[model samples]
Target: MEHRQSFWENLVVVAIALVLIQTFLDDFAVVAGWAWAPREVLLYAGLALDVFFSVEFLTRLYFSFIRRRTGIYFWHERGWIDLLASLPLVLLSSGPAALALWSGSTIALGRASLLNVLKVVKAIRIARVLRLLRLLKVFARIRNTDSTMAQRHVAKVATLSVTVLIATVMLLGIAFSVFDVPSLETAYQSRITTLLAAVEGDLDRGAPIDAGELAARESSLLAVQREGRTLFSRFDSDYYARQVGPNDYGFAERGDFRLFFDLRPVNRDQSRNNLIYFAIIVVTIGALLFAYSPHFALTVTDPLHVMTRGITEANYSLEVKVPRLYRDDEVFELARAYNEHYLPMKDRRSAASADGFDLSMDDVQGLLDD
Candidate 1:
């Protein structure tokens, strides 16, 4: 049967096109450093796509069962692709980052292991890129072409996409970490300086130093030590200037007494910055993958699909029409050759068969070669 497009199918294609547009806009907002509110709205729109696709998959399964082709659809017809792409990717990607933000947890010494586990969880957002495979299935349906060929091409493209994405994310992750070091160090120094001046001012006024009162006044101070002994400590064990790194310690000395502050608020700020950076990466890469996937169909798979289908269905003549937009391409050239040469030769052989003409073996070979 000749390929034909239906109105409802065309409507679905339009919807997919709009979804791709939304994905691009979301990425643009992230790259442009727009406010979070609009970016978030764009992100929630993805949930609707997830729900839409889930329903579409269910509908496909229903038809596959009616046609007794469930196995064929599940494997050969790319039903697995549909199932994977239909997942609630927006929620899956956002949930970990949201938890990181809401928990207000830090990668301080005691919590480092827990934060590492959460970072691993945040990596699940990378799977969101798999949603782009739906573009291949849409092209297959729109063009009435074989899904397997498009699936093969899409797999190759997807591998390249994932490689580039992972590399980009790793480089950015490293960049954020390195750049954060200086800012964190400066913040710690400023906080320490301010607290030291406050304590010294109190001492100059002939006030007795009270470690407990100082710690209560300073939120960043987890503990305060004096004269090589614990004066006041928030945790069970005393955290001294020597026990932790220089960035997590500040000290003051006055003649015979030495005072130490257990400084770790800078570490908390670093963890929050890392979470924000991770969220930005996920949004940008997901948008880019969705925006570019359709171009693969237009330039590569769609034309190949039309040419291969035309050739396969050429029993008497070429019935599938080559898309006019591909006129300058090799696929169009193949279609032209099939129409101008192969069909005429086929017609001649058919006439010979009807007329009882005993053609030579060479003539039969020539006809087959055409």
Candidate 2:
């Protein structure tokens, strides 16, 4: 049971880390038009990870209840953060896509307000950063080792870096969306114009016009209408009605023939600039993180960890070995104090115990030698 628990706990840590990385890559997929991991892959992966986190939250809740530590779990252990990061995120991230698929149509620019609302909601996926805070819970579970504090501080620094990266990605995504929407709309209008011209030519020649054939050839057609009547519809009656609403469909009129086209196909191709921006952001953020990690550990966490271990140990004589490259900074002063002032005072107190009480191994050995 203990080993199984250990395994799952470790798995939770890994999942937390993976999801954070995946969420960042997802921004690249969605906003930057990164083909390496497409939007579909990231969406499904995010859903799967969200499920895993939900299960983890429930399991932790159950165990905490059984142990009669519900308050500790929810409040102190940040079970709320787990729940916050899990279910709401799934709905926010995947909900719009699911709705789009169900309706068999993309929300048109006519519903720009609703589209903007969805964009803001989608931006809430940044809450996935909350998962980083849960890493602190894992740190609390870790055994008291010399490296544990160092590991925790490193995790904190990493979490902060990732949070900043995510924020930058969100801002960039918003900027890209502005340009991308117009580009997609232009593409849709161009396709509709070309098809309208072809249909007009066919009408002039009195060629048999088959909306089904045209739609089949055109992957983006949700439905097609002639003379403002439902000539051919790919949607069910209800969805078709929804598509014909004033703002939902685009129309082109020539003499006696009126043609209406569903504009949802515009989403199939992203703007070229989106792809360029995606590459630049991903490479730059990745390079920055790679360069930052070692320097952060060496200068900050390593020294703090050494001081922590020295201070916590039972031995009064333990000395902090300041690294050769270490500056005469706060950590250096801490080490100097530990080795000189603190250790000497502690040793004097220990030596004053003439009855040889509470003597450590070094003290006993020294006494034996004398």
Candidate 3:
């Protein structure tokens, strides 16, 4: 049972770390226009992790009730934070259900406005920031464990670095959303208008321009083009001269003047969507670092320091017991070994002193005589 519990705990830790990393990469994919397949896979993996976390949380609560430790568990563990952290996943999964119900029902202010409001409410997924509280809980648990002052300081520094990195990423993402998107949108619109005017001028002059030439010209335009929808010029031999189409079209025949503007919303929405993912990614990373730093310090740094201190004090004829670690791991085993050796050596030293065996001169003179 103990081993099984340990396995689950380790699995949870690994899952949390993986999810944090996956979320960050998923955000990068959104901003970089990478393929969606890997991002979708990560999303499903995150959902699976969320399910595991939810089950773990409920299992803890159930055991707490059964053991009559509800008060102590809630007070010390702050189990409420776990519930808050899990809420985003639950709410996100239920969004479609809520939307479907809203769609089927009638609202006094019209379904369009109500649907918009519901869509905004879906942003509640941002509440995933509450997951950071779980990190704080982990930090607290680590601090309460047997660890040296040096280890605690190292953990603090690591946690601070992670926090700063997260803040920097969020700021950079916000700047991209606020400035870069608008500037790009403006440039794209300008390009579209320029192309339209050039085609129009050619049509006015009755220039014999083929549809293929126009398409080739468009292909030569800048690469940072807006995605989703685009505006272009088309030519149709049967249509009136200089006629603009409402939708995108293929190249036109020679002397057919057709312009089509792909009308879609600006890139602001795309940027905002990217920013949302960025926030989620940053928060998850920060939380994971905060939670893991202390564990790392205790496991890797604390035991060595304790052993060093014990040896140093022993040189001064002062017996120093190695501090016992709360974790029953390799570090604890090392501490136990040190104590085992120290106790026997200490007893031998005491026995020698009680027998009045002065090692300075008398013992040396006796050995020489023999």
Global lDDT scores for all candidate models = 0.54, 0.57, 0.48
lDDT of predicted model 3: 0.48
A best-first ranking of the candidates according to their TM-score comes to 2, 3, 1
Runs off by more than 4 Å, candidate 3:
92-122, 132-370
Residue-level lDDT tens digits of model 1 in 1-370: 1233366566567767766556456445544544446655655576666667777788889989999999999987678777766754544643433443347442232112422332333344334444554554444443322455544555445444544554565555545444544555455555655666677787688778788877777666665656577777766643332234333344455533455555444434443443454344445444434454455555566655655654444343443355678666776576667667766776676677653334557878977888
Query: What are the per-residue Cα lDDT tens digits for candidate 3 across 1-370?
Result: 9999999887867766765565456445545544435544555565666666677778888999999998766655556655645555555643332443436431111212422332233233233333443443344344433455543554455445544544454455445434544443345445555665676677689775454555666542311111322333343333312221111111211123433332212222333554564465455545444555555555656566666765654332333334455546776677677667864675577577653333556658888888
Residue-wise C-alpha lDDT for candidate 2, range 1-370, written one tens digit per residue = 9999889978987887777566556554444433322555666677778778888888889999999999998875557767766776666645454455447654442222434543453354334334344444443454333454454554455445544554565566566556555545445555655676687788889897888887776655655656567666666876554323332344445545555555333322322333344344445444434554455556666666666765565453456766677757677777788777887776776678643244567868977888
TM-score, per-candidate, Cα-based: 0.40, 0.49, 0.42
Error of 3 at 145 (Å): 9.0
Q: Between candidates 1 and 2, which one is better according to TM-score?
A: 2
TM-score of 1: 0.40
Q: Pick the candidate with the highest TM-score.
A: 2
Task: Please say which candidate is ahead in lDDT: 1 or 2.
Answer: 2
Off by over 4 Å in 2: 10-45, 61-81, 102-146, 164-319, 323-326, 338-370
